[model samples]
Target: MAASSTATIGSYELTSRAIYEPPAAAVREGSRILDETRRLGSRYGEDYSDGGVESVAAQNASAELAESWKYPRQNVFRTGAAFWSLLTSGANDAAYGALIPYLEEYYNLSYIIVSLVFLSPFVGYILAAVLNNTLHRRIGQRGIGITCGICHILAYIIIAVHPPYPVLVLAYCLAGFGNGISDAAWNAWIGNLDRANETLGFLHAFYGVGGVISPLIATNMIAKADLPWYTFYYVMIGLATIELVSCTWAFWPNGPEVYRQTMDASNEDNQGMKEALFKLPFARVTWLCAAFLLCYVGVEVSVCGWIVQFMIRVRKAENYPAGMTSMGFWLGLAVGRAVLGFVTPLLGVKVAVSVKILARLLEGSLAAFGGSGAAILPFAVGAIAQAKGVKTLQPIILAFLTALLGLWLCLPRIGRKQD
Candidate 1:
């Protein structure tokens, strides 16, 4: 009886031990299954709501990884589309600079009258800025591509037909809206990618490339081939057509539903532009950037737009050589963007900017100085030019440089220590 009880107890003890401790192979298999479960959960997890212990399993899944050119194979095509859009914009913009002289002659107008083309575009640009977010939310990037393409094609067709002065001005407004949309959308898209600085630098370089090539083609068509000014736009129509096709195809998958899903996964898109502009520290940065770019673009456009005329009128240069000067300017800009993209990261942004500022100051103290005064200078310089002739270009440019210095002094204080 004692032996029987002992044996039964031993059997019970063994059974209990087997139940408490799983076999090594079973343990390994179970761990493997758990790991896969976690992987899947993370991969498809909902927005990681912090629900204490329950959220631990999904903590790694909620991260928003930066997109790259490789991961989404389609990004390569999208980027190419973006580059081409900017290229079109560059060509369009540079053409105005090269054709300004021809436009004045064709319309039998003074500088003030011909300058209306430049002013009219601002109306389109302002509207584009206001409507950009709404368009993105409603139709997504696909719509943007289609809409901008239509705008460009329609505008170029109108310009090619050599419409009346008022009609021509209207056409440029349409073109400006298209350029603004592409500019804003593509910049935002590429900026969110990995190595944004280098990418954006290269992107702008394409703009410069367009700038470089446009004047060369426009000048030759007019001076060498003896083609009409309107004929230049025929080339633009073809390029815009390509832009429409590439952009539409590349972003076809990025519809409103896809955009909404992506936005829902990230909280960053929740803030409105008004909120973003008014949000303390960020506001200061935003306003500063806006002001600086306004100045920089003003300087760039003013120089590029007027340089051909200046070369012809002020410098007494022939048609072909005057146009080539603008080509040289754009070439320098393109080279800088391509080369400095690699160099800037190593030098650091702040240091690079400082170096650029220093170099700019040395080369031409007032070369890029600009402000609201500069913006209004078309009217101002027009009046002065009437009284003083084209020689007023020098004085007006000098005045802008002075205004720029004053504007710099009056800029919103950022990062400077208060007394």
Candidate 2:
């Protein structure tokens, strides 16, 4: 059989690479291509003779497949840059909780007024989500890397100057926008890797690492050294500078044109954001996951943002011990992601997510103790704290965790359907 020979099997063209290449790659690409075909409503169940097995096996080689770090080689640098970017985000988020006391003391502000810092970031995040596709269309990942770095750098510089309350809130908004862009871009890029669950586990584990260390450093600077609250941001500025350089260099080759080619944007049937949100099984999964994460992150950052205050005010803990509470939380999160990444594939997504949510619920319930949209829930919790008390966080945590579990259960398992 010539490489170009036609093997009619449900409207697909089989090629030589499918027969010559390893079956693993062929099977992987074959399944993905079939999924795309099914999304387009194609029917496939044709029979062929044993002699036609290779012909039957042939599939489009250009279809994207999950890749490894070494294949492209440059991905190694790209992945490192992503890891650093996430670390910076973690550090930025965790530092706020530790600094809350100092912020109040320095500015002579009440809880709700300070909570505006947490709430202000919400606007930046929403804007990022709205503009993400447009940014991708215009500048590609390279542009995203540069833009995010600049946002962080400028934000940190503004904070380091000890600006007024309104200006400080605006600085956080810029930082949040940077965090939002980097979060979306890197997660999408890394999700294409082989064993993505495990890879992403390590990727986010770095986030945990940052979360763990940030409070420690920020706390010591203020409590022990008696430095001003804004000094920590100078360090943040340095990190952002490095992030800008590393990411820009790594993604320079992957500009707008390359992004278009990689995405196969010219394909008439390619799914858009609208289709992804409205498609049958995908729609169910998407909505459920969004709801679950809104609850999940609301809990995670709310705790990171307010747990220090809770401990200091309600538990009567000193600054260092109070800061440790947040550090401990991040440590557990990091360790769990790294360890469970290995276990999740065996358990499957549905079961794994259920277990995680249930465990978080149990943790919250037991705490009598513990613990945003990326921001709203955290902001709401802070607002509630102003009216009720930080102690109310315990019940709020329990409620959100319970909701997380419910959302997880509602998620439809999206898989290859035989039709």
Candidate 3:
């Protein structure tokens, strides 16, 4: 009886040991699963174990990790999305050119009055610059963007309804105000993004696209007489509405402002905003930007705004219709800006800008002397050379001339930096 009892006890003990001890295969699989879970949790923070620990070091680490995950992803999406929004918004400016004829015909506006209508926006631009930093700080980038969108829509509506000439000027001013606000605010926002210089070029490229499309659409609508001239304003109003919605939804919580503040604080710690604006570094950059902007706008406005008149009255170029000339100019501008997008990075901003300015001067000189065909040749050559590289001394000379001109403009505000 004692021997039998002892055997039963031994058998029970063996069974219990086998049940508790897992097989080698099962143990290896479990370990691998645990390791994978730990690695993934570290990589993506999916595991809450470390996150739940109540320590200051752990909290700081988690916060940093969260920020790292958020900004890169957000910036990637925002850069492209913002570019599209800006493009659509800017395209509406093409309507300004179409309005010239209407104002001349319906309002009996003299050349001075018409010119003022074109120039009034600059006033708004100047005013917006004065108020931009403060307004952005008070309202945040997204809020300011929404406000600009609203103002833009309203301005378009006012113009579309054929307000009196004074009121029309006011409407144009308001549109300019919207544009200036958006330009300053959104540019600052984009500059705050990672890879700012590259992203900024892309963002501006969209503006170029918008500028191209605007004239085409405006000219087409007018040519068709599909609706009253004022109806074009409605189209713009609709675009502004879309911009408002986009600003509100896609760019909310205002992360851009925080970035802007950080950047501004770091860069301008000792300087007042106004003082900062006039400082050598700031002045140098601004002078370059201004020169680029001025020459670009002058060339673009002349081509789109006056080309039709020039063609019909001056050159009498073949296939030149009232609208066709403007269309061609817009197409050229769009293509030029698109090509510049890729070319600018390669050449660097200073060189790319010098090239553009040189092209403008050459085109202007050619137009003055040899008429349209000769002017077109310089532009065409410059565009091709941008991609193909200059093979001859002529392009090299032109490029040198452009650099000299840019330096001339830049030297007054800021002395040349030491090599």
Candidate 4:
């Protein structure tokens, strides 16, 4: 298993390294998701909080027990809608990142203030994490989806109008909150679906699709289009409006609020969340997963978020063409996820003989899809930035270097022989 394979993109060897381990029992036993969750649930399932498998099993059943949710059309619609929702969010994620430099100019603010636009979304994710269980049980996932759609709508409207800086920040924060709830609920719902892994893959793939398209559109608007710079947000408003209708159609279920997984009382669910949070082993694993993701997202967001500025500053590339650099990175990500997903199972994890590669790429294509593509390609472009100039590529190089370091630190065992 030569984990390192160099595919050429022009002169450079796009040498991605990977160590491919087969799936474990949990993933291997695909159809047994609920049964397996039940078995795990019977023991310490209640300790697995945040609307995941660790519940009291309201009727000795999982969230999959809701009969009203079993409509074939509805299932397909829900999954499709979720995919679109992710796509829309993905677009916003990258668009805003690309927009950062523009935002700084428009708001006449320092980096910290402009950066708040990104931080505000976390406010939504945190609130969603805290209230996901209670809210879903109360308002139904459909309601949350609709709310998320509206939040996006309102947020885009505010941005399009070019309100005062404080107002812009508040609007972004609101959108982030919606984004958080929608993301949590839809993922949880999809996790309970048939062919859950593949469905989840699709959901994220669309996210990459959004990521790829966002910069292409946003760059043209701000850097090239004769339309107002705010025109990009006007397009977003249209998309968000369509998303609202789609969510309502997919999730509303003929106006019935039928999303409670069971008839269990509310207090019991709270106790389940508490127990999950308090348990040492579960809490430890949970936090580790969180830390890994924090690093992963930090890389993804940082690279996608900053690449446009990188190109402008370092390469002195034209704004319109520079946008393509970010677009290419996300395109690689989306393609990596889709292509490698179909191929990883074909080969076992192997080693590559060459210069040291990034640890995550050596982990495999599935690994690359997560956020590796987001950081790798654009940053690689940054590496060459100095060659054209006298060493202007430092920012891009340093940024990706930090990403690789984060992956290495988080997963020290990657690409290493197990003793």
TM-score list, all predictions:
0.74, 0.79, 0.63, 0.67
Candidate 4 per-residue lDDT, tens place, 191-302, comes to: 5444344555667688889999888888887777645667799888887887888988888862324554342522344454344345664344333444455556656776
- Name the top lDDT candidate: 2
Of the candidates numbered 3 and 4, which has the greater TM-score value? 4
Model 4 segments more than 4 A misplaced: 1-71, 254-257, 263-276, 339-419
Name the runs in model 1 displaced over 4 angstroms.
1-65, 270-275, 347-387, 398-419
RMSD of 3: 15.8
lDDT values, one for every candidate: 0.72, 0.74, 0.56, 0.61
Worst 10 residues of 3 by lDDT: 366-375
lDDT digits (tens) for residues 100-142 of candidate 1: 8999899998887777776666766766766766787788899
User: Which digits, one per residue and each the tens of the lDDT, describe model 3 over residues 312-335?
Assistant: 444555322565666556566666
Per TM-score, the best of the predicted structures is 2
Q: Is 1 or 2 the stronger prediction by lDDT?
A: 2
Over 377-411, each residue of candidate 2 has an lDDT whose tens digit, in order, gives: 77788788889988988899999888888888787
Name the TM-score of candidate 3. Answer: 0.63
Give per-candidate clash totals: 0, 3, 0, 9
What lDDT would candidate 3 get against the real structure?
Answer: 0.56
Candidate 3: segments with Cα more than 4 A from true spot: 1-71, 255-285, 315-320, 347-419
RMSD in Å for all candidates:
10.5, 9.5, 15.8, 18.5
Give candidate 1's whole-model lDDT: 0.72
